[model samples]
Target: MSEKRPVMTWLTDMDGVLVREEDAIPGAAEFLRRLTESGCKFLVLTNNSIYTPRDLRARLAESGLDVPEENIWTSALATAQFLSDQRPRGSAYVVGEAGMTTALHEVGYVLTRSRPDYVVLGETRTYSFEAITTAIQLIVNGARFIATNPDSTGPSPAGPLPATGSVAALITRATGVEPYFVGKPNPLMMRNALNRIDAHSETTVMIGDRMDTDVVSGMEAGLRTVLVLTGSTTRDQVERFPYRPTRVVDSVADLVDDIVPPPPTESE
Candidate 1:
């Protein structure tokens, strides 16, 4: 009889769990391979709404990881899906890049400034004052506010750069309207990702480097969570959070043995 795997699906963060600063973490490829051979459904999640799946795949491939486009899940995609479900064929005034805008378009959302139903905010290095002004006015005009993620800063070659959450705060300050954040730390995002792969939370495992967003989200989503110390959070810092991960590892490299191989049948 084969050793039954404990988990049937996996959800992992992109930056710390798999790749960090454009380099694949040790054993990330092997972990992915193991999942492939075991036929477990998985999604590599990212809160950054700047890159599309194809873009992310290319970037990962450069880092020696072979994640398929479909395996990648972005906050932009989640935001678009949420909006589409909330209001089919809705209109929005968007402040984001191609990733966010294209996702919205794919979901049949019309981008307009004239009486839009939503003011959707997403990450972009190129935050335009004109666009921000437009979005603020739109939200004040009874337009619902939505944001891709609440990540305040993103890693960059030159250090931290302002991300969606910071920009969302600026808008909130100007309009007194807080946007509905649609990324990690929100159990809805986890549930939506699980639904995408037809996976049950009880049978899935979530891996990440952050305690607040990754661990908390997974715990709330009712999945086992793992924290790797390869990215943001540290061992000492973990104790600061009341909620904890299912386990903690040095890095993704330490997870190879976590996937128990199948045993041979008696006939064999």
Candidate 2:
């Protein structure tokens, strides 16, 4: 029989794996502590671009988890990095929030108030028709189209709210140009995270609640995938999905149990 592989690194989802809405999931903080103490590298990789790493860290800290800002990676950051490396010197017209704009600026991309080199789309709670029209105009005028993620809707304590994909769809319908996605299901985001940690594909494990984005991306990148039941995906939903994770657990606490070795015996 082939030897079982050991997972050396983890790519985790934030919203569900660590926190749910405004509350932290049970044992998430201790789980992280255990993983860190074990010398296992992990990054909180999320498709949500509404907040920067610092912002996310602060939010997580509010829920009693003190994670470093550098340990967090967002689709917004990945999108900015991809654009900075691929696109020429040009202005970015963002249809998102300050977080998205801040990410682009941090990546050395210029954000323009008028004509732009690209129309970057992301989730805006206050999406306006004027902003949509502006994006369409820019795309029609030969500006590149980019989207942070293709999530149609995001789950919330209240209910599901229209996500960035919905806005991207409207712009696509108007400009007839599909946006290049930098989020999950696209290997770009995961590759960026791996690069950040200086880890290889074989050593990484992706822990997330979504199958289509998280699990598929990890599998495609040749990483082990762990599906948790604390988010959008459920035990029943996995049966319906064609793709399957390498492992399944109820929460991040279970993940800690899977990876951590037991204490040494005194006799030894």
Candidate 3:
């Protein structure tokens, strides 16, 4: 049970492992190319709920990664799926951008602030006081609260910006209610992604740059995990966490040869 079965699927985090600040990290393109040619089932995961898969794919392509639309998975999608499964065609008081709205719409959710079934909070460039007030009011009145991810801040060109979890905390302090986060570290999100591609945890490897969200979630979901020191988490910071990744490396560049199987021999 210590060693996992051969890797037949992959779940990689988007920001630090593959790209940073909308720029592809060094060796990211080649690693993605290797995944594509290897014919393994994989998805690039992100906590950001601002953009749809198509948008993210285009961004990655611009950064030279060339990831497909289908290969992208986001917290927005997971949140929508969770809501749909919980209550079909439910209404929500959503606070975010097009990505969150589009996902909820696609899943047959009605966006509203009047006695909504849920108060769905996600990441956005501008988190308005008006929107926060509306969200708090809706939740206080009895709507369930759901957040996309728990990461307190997101990487940006200028600096780290307050993200979904940080805003959720404010609302919690106001109303004394907490939100159920549907993104990484939940393990539920990981299970949902695995089911999406018909993947089994024993045969999948999760690659991420942060141990708190990605690695912990993957390990809890029974998938082998790899932590790369290319994102928010540094080598020195890893020991502080109670949980550890199954493997730790400098970056994805070190993982290409380990995860990808060799091509079939010509002699055969």
State every prediction's TM-score relative to the real structure. 0.94, 0.93, 0.94
Summarize candidate 3's per-residue lDDT along 1-268 as a digit string, tens digits.
Answer: 2364678888999999999877888888888888888888899998889999999988898888898888888999999999999999999998999889999999999998889999999999999999999999889899999999898987777888999989999999999999999999899889999999988998888999888899999999999999999888888898999988888889899877765653344995
Write down the RMSD of candidate 2 (Cα, Å): 3.9
Q: What is the Å distance of residue 190 in model 3 from its true position?
A: 0.6
Candidate 3 deviant stretches above 4 angstroms: 1-3, 261-268
For 1-268, candidate 2 gives per-residue lDDT tens digits of: 0144566777898888899998999989988898788877889998888888999899999999988998999999898888888874558999998679888988778888577878899877888888888889989988989999999998876898999998899888888899999999898899999998988888678989889999999988888888999988889889988789988899988867666532443996
RMSD, one per candidate, in order: 3.2, 3.9, 3.0
Q: Per model, how many backbone clashes are there?
A: 0, 0, 0
User: What TM-score number comes out for model 2?
Assistant: 0.93
Question: How displaced is residue 39 in candidate 1, in Å?
Answer: 1.1
Clashes of 3: 0
Cα-lDDT of candidate 2: 0.86
Q: List the residue pairs that clash in candidate 2.
A: none
Q: lDDT of each model, Cα atoms only?
A: 0.90, 0.86, 0.90
Q: Which stretches of candidate 1 lie over 4 Å from their true place?
A: 1-5, 260-268
